[model samples]
Target chain A: MDLFISLFINGLATGMLIFLLAAGLTLIFGLMDVLNFAHGGLFVWGAYSGIFVYTWSGSFIVGILGAIVTGFVLGWITEKLIITPVYGNHVQQILITLGFMLVLSECIKVVFGPNSIPVDVPSYLAGSWEIGEVIVIKYRIFIIVIGLVIFGIFQYVLKKTKIGLIVRAGVMDKEMVQVLGINIKRVFLFVFMTGSAMAAFGGMLMAPYSGVIYAEMGMEYAILGFIVVVIGGMGSFSGSLMAAILVGLAGSFMAYYVPYLSLAVNMILMAIVLIFRPQGLFTNAKEG
Target chain B: MRHEKYFSLKNLTFLIIIIALIFFPYVADSRTLTILMTQIFIFSILAMSYDILLGYTGIVSFGHAMFFGIGAYTTAILLSTYNNTMMIFLISIIVGMIFAGIVSFLVGLLTLRLKSHFFAMLTLAISGLFLVVAEKWRTVTKGNDGFTFRAPDVFRDRVIFYFFVLVCLVVVFLVLRRFVNSPLGKVLIAVRENEQRTRSLGFRTLHYKVTASVVAGVVASLSGSLYAISLRFVNTSVMSMDITLDALLMTIIGGVGTLIGPIVGSLVIETAQHYLSGLANDYPIFERWIIFFGMLYILAVIFFPKGIVGTVYVKYLTWKSKKAKPQLPTQSVPLVKDKERFE
Candidate 1:
């Protein structure tokens, strides 16, 4: 029972982080119709920047803010320079963003050197809480809370506000939304920035969780993020969250039980979804 | 009526490329030749197979390496304990084709239903999942330690594995070339050009996509098998996203829709990467190779998006049109019509 609880918690935390990355990824894909492979690069940058600042300042909150700002700057530059030019061309966007992914990865090595950096949890979040022989890592709970909070904020924004309405409507019909008098370019920029920030935040949080940050971690987790997005639905935000949790739990449990199949489990899930629900779990987008 | 062939540019250029590739191992240092030629052949096959989906059928699969890896592993496992190189090769090809066809068919059913970009994203996710499986599923795959096998006799005699690859490539090129020009090939092209219209014509476009994808998968696996033969090695890296990117880059650089583009593109990129990395031992400038690759892709698309072969064909056609008799405008018919559509 304790083992199951630990795996469940661990999985939920990982899922929440993936949800954060996938949220940004799906938003960009839906809003601009641009497939951003560099989304992972942005997430990695967030992890590095947030952790760097956290270590320097010896403060966890400051690290989170730093990561967000780093994501914003990185995203803004990427949108203006790389994404804007290749807005309508899927091939161009993929190539350029993949290039950007490499460039970002290289840049990480340049900034922090080509080695892994050790990440530490805050003092208050380091210890485990034991209840009747069931021990739960405090930091895992903290990450889960952060993920849920972010989801709530985005959900509220998506459902209640004007920006949310534009985002939701834009995902439904980006071309029509453009014809309706809003500057879709601005929306693209906004989505790009938001997505990057969210990805970066995920990175920063994940850095401590993994306890070390490396350049390739972005690509690795980005893969996880992408899987979550696909499993959830491309343009569906809440779907990312739910799918992420499912994936997280599946991975956690699979790691313990059927160790060999754990790696393939996500793919098998994707294949099954592609077979049964290619539209994804929470997606309502029209099929092409 | 049979079109009169005064050596069409595609045929002529393809011949030139084939000849150059054939001479590669002979002229260059054995080590350099082996590495570059082998990489080129592997990617050439990869790019050609990719053309079926990306160029001919118009399904952008970001995770095509999954099939390539499947073939490599299949061949590796088959050949590891078995001695009949020919039988193993044949079995591996069938295994690769069947596996790719089945997986892609199932995946294509739903993801292919997605619009273009989303479809690509699904492939990426699915491939990523494959990587994790490859890395962690150590029992069957030996996990990160990977798997190794003795290099097969390769060509059985003096031809060497490189020449065998060359021969296989030539045969594949011929087969695919014929397929593209055939009725089925035309339908695949039609699907790429306008699926809805083809559907309106009562053709099942999805079936063609799956069929083309299966053939492409088989071809890609052939390359993977050849790669295993070449190196006498197999590892999880065969399924890595890096290989997928390399293949995509080659296909794009060679030209998206052109048949011969991938072959030419692979030769150019792999040779350059080889020389660039050979420059230093420490840095290998391999990272710089990535930089160049990244830069080359953007520059290639921005400046000559049609790819080297595509641009060459266009230029050749343009020059030929100018050289042709000013008296007959009919010679410029195809070129003029294509340009008109683009404009």
Candidate 2:
């Protein structure tokens, strides 16, 4: 029971991390139809930058803020420079973003060195609570809480705000939104920035959770993000969260039970999904 | 067809290149260059195979290295166990190709129906699974520290190996060219241009795609076999995403639909990589040369979206048309007459 709970929590935390990355990806992809392979680059940058600030300022919150800022700025620049040119061309987008991803990852290596940096949970969030036979790690709970809060906030903003309505409308039909006299380009830029910021925020959160941050982590997690996005519907937000949790739990359980097949389980899951529901588990019927 | 005879510029250039490649080993001063040329040949074959799917069929696969890796591992395992040189090498390549074809056929059946990005993503996932299997199946694969094998006596000679690989490259290129120019290839092109239209026209687009995949997989495995023979070693890097990306970059850089473009692409990229890494010691800036490589890739995509060969081909056609503009006056006069009569 204890093992199951811990594993469940572990899986949820990882899933939430992936959801953070996938949410931005799916949103950017959903609205803009841009496949930003450099999303992973934004992630690792956030991890490194957040960790740097955390060490410098001695506050995790400041680190998170710094990472978000970094992400927003980078995202804005990327949208303007890299992504704008290849709009509506999937192949070009994939190729250029992949190139940019390499640049981002290499730049990280150049700046921070190629070594993985170890991170620690904050002092307040370091210990675990023991309730009878169940020992609950504080950091995992913190991650879950943070993930839920962000999801709630994101959902609220998306549901209630004018920008949210425009984004949702844009996702449905850019032409329709443009016909309605909304600036779809501006919306695209805003959404791109927001999505990048979320990815960075996820990276920042992941640093201490994984206990190590590396340049290559972006690609690794980005694949997970892609998997989650695929498993969820391409642009469906709630689908990403659910699919991420499923992937996370599956990964965790498989790792413990069938260690050899652990790496392959998600892929097998993806393959099965592709065979049956190629559109994904929770895709909005009309979106595609 | 009459325009593409021995005197044509295209044929002449091809003949010249083939002749030069034939004589290269004999006249070359450095053994390193001969080895590099061999490497280029192997990669060119791999890139050409990739072009069949990406260029001809419009199927962007991310797991192409899986086929190449399969070829390498098959050869490696066979040679390691067996002392008979001819038997093992031939058997390994044949088995590798068969295995790759079978796997691709299965994979295509599952994945070819997906949207472009979904297909690419799924292939990546599938390839990642192959990587894991290769890394973990230590009993057969020797895991990360890949095993080495002895090649037949004929292949041990660098010049012999060079010519052998060159022949393979040229043969594969010709075969693929034939494949692409065939009536079926036209169907593949049609499918690439508009799958819905092709489907509506009563063509089984999926079968054509699967056939392309199998052909590509077989050719890629052949290259992989050559790659293992050239290195006398097998490792996971052969099947890594990097290899797939390298082939992709090569195909894009050269010219997608042009059969000869990938060869040129491989030559350019491989030579540049060799020289760039060599210069890293002299220049601190070159120490992180991958940044520059990435920058170049981005610039290439932006500036030469049609690729080098495709752009050149377009330019040649425009220039030729401009040169023939004097003849168009007669044609336009008739059109003018027709327009006046209609009025």
Candidate 3:
């Protein structure tokens, strides 16, 4: 029971992180119709920049803010320069975004040097809690709480706010939304920025959770994010959270039980999902 | 008259390139250039195979390296075990082709009918699955350390191997050219242009896609086999994302859908990589040469979206039409017209 609880918490923590990234990816894909392969680049940049600020300013809050700000700026620039030119062209979008991904990853290496850097959890969040035979890591709980908080805030905004409604409406029918006289282009840029910020924020949180940050970690985690997006059903927010948790749990349990298959477990899950539910587990049927 | 002119120019360029490649080994006589050119031949084959899917059939795949890796590993394992070059080479080609065919068929069946991005992602996952297995299956793949094998005497001589690879490349190029110009290839173009309409035309689009996938896989595996022989070593990198990306880049850079364009793209990219890496040794700034390549890639997509050969081909057509009096559209002209949208 203890082992199961521990694994479950571990899985939940990782799932939350993946959900943060995938939420942005699916949202961007939904609204902007851009795959944004460079999403991973934003994640790694957040990790590196957040860690850099944390190490320099000695304040985790400042680091998180800095990372989010960096993500927004990068997102704006990428959308204007790289993405705008390739709109409505999936092939060009994939190729250019992939190129940007390479450039961003390489830029990280250039800035941070070609080595993985270790990061420490903030002192207040360090250590663990023991309840009977179950010992829970405090950082893991913190991650889960933060993830849920972000999800709740976004959900509230998405459900109640004007901008959120517009965004969702845009995802459903961009032409129709534009016909209603809202500058859908501005909304696209805004949504892309917010999505990127979320990805960076996830990376910032992931740095301390994983205890080490590297340039290539973006690509690694991006693959997981893509898997989550696929499993959750593209353009479905709640589906991302659910699928992420399932993938997280599956990965955690597989690692412990079938170590050899751990690396491929997410991929296998994706394949199974693709085969059985090609539209994904929770697709927006109306759009499809 | 226009058809004759176009064919003569294309034929002339093809003949010149083939003759140059045939004589390159003897003319250069430098071992380094020979090896480099040989690598180009192998990759050109790989890129051309990829063009069949991306350019001809409008299918985007991210797991082509799986087929290439299968070919390499099969060849390595066979040679290491059998110690007979002729039999091992023959067996590896057949086994590699079959293995690649089976995998592509399964992957195509599962993902091809879905939206394009799903197919791309699933292919990536499938290739990554193969990569993981290749790394973990220590008893067979020897894991990440990779394995080495002795090649037959024929392959030992760089010049003989160079000519051999060149011949294979030319043969593959000619065959693929014939394929793309055939009636079936036109159907593939129609599918690319409009899948729904093609299905309404009573064509089994899925079967055609599957056929293209198998053909591409088989050809890619052959290149992988040659790559293994050239290196006398096989490793997991042969099945990596980088290799797939390289093929994609080459196909895009040379001209996506044009059979000869991939060869040009491979030559350009391989030469760029060669010189760029070499420059890194002299200038510290060039240490991050991949950054420049990334920038170049972005710029290429923005500016030269049609690719070098593709752009040049368009220019030639424009020039030819300008010289001739405006005439009624013909079949060949319409085919060229269909390709213009990619630009």
Candidate 4:
């Protein structure tokens, strides 16, 4: 029972990290109609920046904040330079974004050097909470709480705020929103920044969980985030949540039970999802 | 005109080019001969395969390497464990084709419901998922250990692989050329230009897409088999997004619609890669193939949207017209001659 409890918590924590990354990805796709393959690059950049700041400043919170800011700047520049030109053409977007993914990843090696850095849990979140025979790490619970909070805050902002409404509106009909005299491009810039920041935040949070930050970590988790987005349906927020959870649980369970297909399990899940429901589980948003 | 084909200059030019390609390999040095021929055979097959999805069906796939990798891996594993290359080739080709078809069949069934953009993203995601799995699953794949075969025999070496590829490329090319010229090809073209219109044409467009997709899978598998045999190894690199992008770029650079385009595209690209790397070794200042190739790609897409072959073919036609009427103007005559110097 304790083992079961441990596995469940571990899976939940991983799922939250994946959710944070996937949330950003789905939001970008939902609103922009651009599939940023470099999304993983952002996640990795977040990890490196967050970890660097954490080590230099000796403050975990400050490290995370710095990471988000870094992601925002990168996102703004990337949007202006790379993504802005290839809006309507999927092929061009893919080519350019993929190139950016490689460049961004390589830049991580340049900035941080080609070594994985160890990041320890902050003292405040270092302990474990025991419930009868079950023990849960304090940081895992913290991750879950943080994940829930981010989801809640974003959900509330999306549901009750004008900015959220505009984003949702943009997702549904960019032209219609443009007709109403709103600068959809600015909105895109804003969403792109927010999404990048969110991914960075996820990476910052993931550093301690994985116990190390490597340049390739972004590619690794970015793939998981992508599968979640696909299974959850592209651009569907609630769908991302459900899909992330499903993939998380499946990954956790399958790793122990069917070890051979462990890596392939997620792929199989995605393939099956694509086969049965290709538009994804949620495609209700009307977009042109 | 003595023949219907001769009535059209394009067909006549195509015939001439085909005849030249067959003869040029004989005159080239061994290294250049093998490399260029391999590029033509491999990329022509890949481009033809890609056309099944891109040109004919209008579905742009960012992950076509999944089939290619699967084919290569299956063949490498079989060939390493067994001796009969023919049987292994047959099994791997079938497996790769079937697996790809099944995956696409399922993916297409679902994604075909979405818009083209969403569907394309889904394919990209699926291939990426495959890459991650291939990389991490260290047991069967030896993870990244990557299996290599013993150099089989001299007669069973590069030349042998070259011949094998030649036969496959010609067969696949002719079959597809015929298919596209047939009623089936019209259905595919119709689907691409207008999906709803094709559907309203009382055709099950989904079935046509699935069929084209499988054909593409089979052809890609053929290249994969040759790649595995020639390189004497099979690894996840075959399935990586880079190779898939190369195939996409090859098709894009060559022009997607024509049979000759990918062949030309691959010839330009692989040669670029070979020469670029060679240049990198000679001049350390130009070490970055990434920047160099990226610039070339950007220029091609931005300035010459028609692709290398398509744009050149257009230029050739314009020149032909001017050459036929050298009486037009000496100024125009110089321009035609100058342009001919470049192609």
What fraction of the true interface does each of the listed models get right, in terms of native contacts kept? 0.36, 0.57, 0.57, 0.13
How well is each residue in B251-303 modelled by candidate 2, as lDDT tens digits? Answer: 88887777877888899889988998899799856667778778877887877
Q: Fnat for model 2?
A: 0.57
Q: Candidate 1 at A198: error in angstroms?
A: 0.8
What is the lDDT, from 0 to 100, of the residue B85 in candidate 2? 82
Model 3 over residues A27-104: C-alpha lDDT tens digits? Answer: 998887778889999999999999999999999999999999999999999999999887877767778898899899
Q: Give candidate 2 misplaced runs (Cα > 4 Å).
A: A284-288, B1-3, B326-343
Native-referenced Cα lDDT, model 2 = 0.87
Find the 10 residues in a row with the least total lDDT in model 4 chain A.
A279-288
By lDDT, highest first, what's the ranking? Answer: 3, 2, 1, 4
| TM-score of each predicted structure versus truth | 0.89, 0.95, 0.95, 0.82
User: lDDT score, residue A78, model 3?
Assistant: 95
Off by over 4 Å in 3: A284-288, B1-9, B326-343
| Model 4: CA > 4 A from native | A55-58, A88-96, A106-133, A275-288, B1-40, B84-114, B121-143, B150-157, B275-288, B291-305, B314-343
lDDT of each: 0.80, 0.87, 0.88, 0.76
When summed lDDT is taken over every stretch of 10 residues in candidate 3 chain A, the lowest stretch is: A279-288
- In terms of lDDT, the best-performing candidate is 3
Question: Which pairs of residues collide in candidate 1?
Answer: B138-B143
Give lDDT tens digits, candidate 3, residues B1-343. Answer: 1245655866887888788878888889799999999999999999999989988888788899999998899888998989847777888878988988888888888878777778878888999999999999999999888888998778788999898898899899889888888888888888876778999999999999988898899999999999999999888999898899889888887887788789889999889888988898888667777788788778878887767887787777667777897653233221112222112
On residues B13-117, what C-alpha lDDT tens digit does candidate 1 reach at each position?
A: 768977887787667756656766767877898899998888778677888898888888888888776874676777876887688778777767667766676
- Residue A223 displacement in candidate 3 (angstroms): 1.3
> Model 2 over residues A1-288: C-alpha lDDT tens digits?
999998999999888898899999999988898878899999999999999999999999999999999999999999999988767766667878988998999999888888899999999999999988988999989988988888998898889999988888887878888888987889999999999999999999999998999998898899888988888988888888999999999999989999999889888888888778877898765665
Q: Against the true structure, candidate 4 has what lDDT? A: 0.76
